[model samples]
Target: MKKLLTMFITFFKIGAFTFGGGYAMIPLIEAEVVDKQNWIDKEEFLDIIVISQSFPGALAVNSSVFIGYKIGGLIGAVLALMGVVLPSFFIILIVAHFFLQFRNNHIVDLLFKGISAAVPVLVLSGIDKLAKSLDKSVDNLIILIISIVAVTIFNIHPILIISFAAIYGILFLRKKVD
Candidate 1:
């Protein structure tokens, strides 16, 4: 019971404090779950990030639910989900009511601009952390380069790229012993 409450509170704090959406929340989620709580290890967290991004819905929501389920089963998943979602829900409600009034205000405009500027930096930080976690093998590097080109130059969908990578790993990346 106590652990469940803690999970709920932790997710609620994350959902409440983060401003730049799912990618921005990655650092905080890693800090809390991997570094602070030890609820999940770094490798598992990375796997969760990959799996979360591969699916639909917000990354924050999917990752929170996966961590919650891993830690505390179905109930945990529900609580973690609710914790992460409620803050945004309430904030959006409040913003919807009040933002129109403040929309044209100079200070409000500046505030939003400042926040918007910070979002990309947060995303880059998350990417750096994830990249550092990966094994720096040449095969991985080649795959990374190809994936980047596919996404940036060819405008390929990430799900398709991930699916191809998974299939390639399954078919050819296996280690063999004599």
Candidate 2:
């Protein structure tokens, strides 16, 4: 009971304060769950991230549900999902109600600008953390370079990359293990 409440409160705070969407929430979630809460280790967190990204929904919501389920089963998943969603829900309602009135306000514009500026930094931090967790193998580096090329140069979709990577792991990496 206590654990569930704590998880809810933690997610609620994250959902309320994180200015950007799922990518921006990554660092904050990592801090709370991996660093502070000790709910999951870095490797598990990375796996959750990959799985969450593979899913079709919002990254933060999907990750939250997975983490909650891992920690506290079905009920935990519900509470965590609610905790993370409610803040955005309420804030969107408030914003939708008052946005017209504040549309022309310079302060509001500046506030948005500041938040937009910070979001990239948070995302970069998350990428850095995730990168540090990966094994320093040549194959990983080759994959990383190829992925960058595929996305930036060729403009390939991420889903395709993930699929290829999964297949490579299953076929090649599995053989190495066996």
Candidate 3:
């Protein structure tokens, strides 16, 4: 019971404060879940991030659910999901009510523009952390380069990229125990 409440509160704080979607929430999640709470180690957190990204749905929600289940089963998953979603839900409701009124406001426009600029930085920071955590091997580096090129230059869908990567990993990266 206490653990569930703590998870809820932690995720609630994360959801309430974070903007710019899941990528932006990565560092915060890492700090709270890994550093502060010691719920999971950095390597496990990284694995969660990868798994969350590979699946459909928002990364933050997926991660919350995964962590919740790991910590406290089904009920925990629900609590964590609610905690992370409630803030966004209420904020959106309030914003939707006034969005029309502020649609033409210059200050609102400027604020949004600033947020747009900052969102990329947040995502890049997450990427930097992920990169640092990755195995510093030639194969991993090659895959990373290929993935970037496929997504950016060739415009391949991420789902397809993930699929290919999974297959490649299974076929080539697997090692047999003797």
Sort order, TM-score high to low? 2, 3, 1
Tens-digit per-residue lDDT, 76-176, candidate 2:
99999999999999999999999999999999999999999999998898889889998888888988999899999999999999889889888888876
Among the numbered candidates, top lDDT falls to 1
Candidate 1's C-alpha runs over 4 A off are: 175-178
Residue-level lDDT tens digits of model 3 in 79-162: 989989999999999999999999999999999999899988988899988888998988888998999999999999999999
The local distance difference test score of model 1 is: 0.94
When superposed on Cα atoms, how far off is each prediction in RMSD?
Answer: 1.6, 0.9, 1.3
Give the alpha-carbon lDDT of every model.
0.94, 0.93, 0.93
For candidate 1, the 10 contiguous residues with the lowest summed lDDT are 169-178
Pairs with steric clashes in candidate 3 = none
lDDT (tens digit, per residue) of candidate 1 on 1-178: 9999999999999999998999999999999999999999999999999999988999999999999999899999999999999999999999999988999999999999999999999889999999999988888898999999999999999888999998777777876311
Candidate 2 segments exceeding 4 Å error:
none
TM-score-best of 2 and 3 = 2
Clashes of each: 0, 0, 0
lDDT-wise, the better of 1 and 3 is 1
Error of 3 at 177 (Å): 7.6
